[model samples]
Target: MVELAETVSDVARSEDRKEFDALVQRYHKQAYNIAYRMAGNHADAEDLTQEAFIRAFRFFGQYRRELPFDSWLYKIMSNVFIDRLRRKPKAMIRSLDQPVVTSEGEAQFDVPDNSAGPEETVLSREMDSRIQAALDTLPEAFRLTVIYADIEGMSYEEIAESTSTNIGTVRSRLHRGRRLLRNKLKSYANQLV
Candidate 1:
């Protein structure tokens, strides 16, 4: 990644379109994933990701080379998402079959046991729905914190850098976010049974 970053930095400094394209190719999928988590749907996620790249390109000259590119991109994406939310906040209703796009390929939430009964499938879906709903209820700060820390598997320090906040703030937000999620999910625990 260090070599890749250095190459990207060099290309970006030279203002070469091809080099920029390489940078985009390297990070677009991850950007889309972050946007997908924030937007909660593919269409909006695509739009947000595109907008983030456009903004990143437009402001590439202003980007500090010392900072991690992904962190810088994530900051742009986070701001884009926040602006969109302010303009129009909408509920996310994801289909059960929606394939989550990942580097490995598309994946979906599934029962571990292939022979799982219909009842088990239904229960799994319900649980997933409940958890998503609970997540949706959180404030953007808390939601993004949880998404970055847990869903995206980013470390607390990475999250802090991406969010432009100190590690202490990141930890606090994560703790508060998880507590809220736990409380929200507890209410639906009996329904899953």
Candidate 2:
């Protein structure tokens, strides 16, 4: 990574396109999700993700291999996506009303039939939808930190490094972000009861 980071300013960095390609292959999904987590829509995610990789390659020399390469890449992707999103402030709010897209084309959430009435079943599903919406409503930085640390299963140190934030801020953001999400979710909690 030290060598890679040096590549950023060192005019004579490694010219091995294959090596960089390999790195891309390894992190494509990770990068895409960070974009998705930041940008929300698949179309925007695709564009932002591609642009991030392009930017990374353009600045590959700055990559410090001593640090985690994945973290650096994620930071780049998150920043790019968030920046693009920042340009379209209205888009983010409009996206909240967008439909949920579940992977595998099937619902993973099961409304346990613990005597759930038809109304209860519907309410449960609505709550689930609202939770997803609230998550999307969160600010990009807070959302990405929480998604990486919780949904994507990254550690605090990893998240902090990726976001260029300190561990304490990472923890604080995660806590506050979830708290805000819960508050948003509470608006629909009556449906749960």
**What TM-score against the true fold does each predicted structure earn?**
0.67, 0.67
Top candidate on lDDT is 1
CA lDDT of each candidate?
A: 0.78, 0.73
The Cα error of candidate 2 at residue 186, in Å, is 2.6
Candidate 2: list runs displaced more than 4 Å.
1-14, 92-129, 187-193
Number of clashes in every candidate structure? 0, 8
Residues forming the 10-long window of minimal summed lDDT in candidate 2: 107-116
Q: What is the per-residue lDDT of model 1 for residues 23-126, given as tens digits with 9 covering 90 to 100?
A: 79999988886777676557777898999999998887787878778888988877887777667657665555578889999998553332246764544655
User: What is the Cα-based lDDT of residue 116 in candidate 1?
Assistant: 40
lDDT of 1: 0.78
User: Candidate 2 lDDT, tens digit per residue, 1-193?
Assistant: 8977676635554564566899989988877766665665677778998999898888886777687777778778767866877787556343334555677574334323323367645444545556656778888788888788876798998888777889999999999998998788775656645
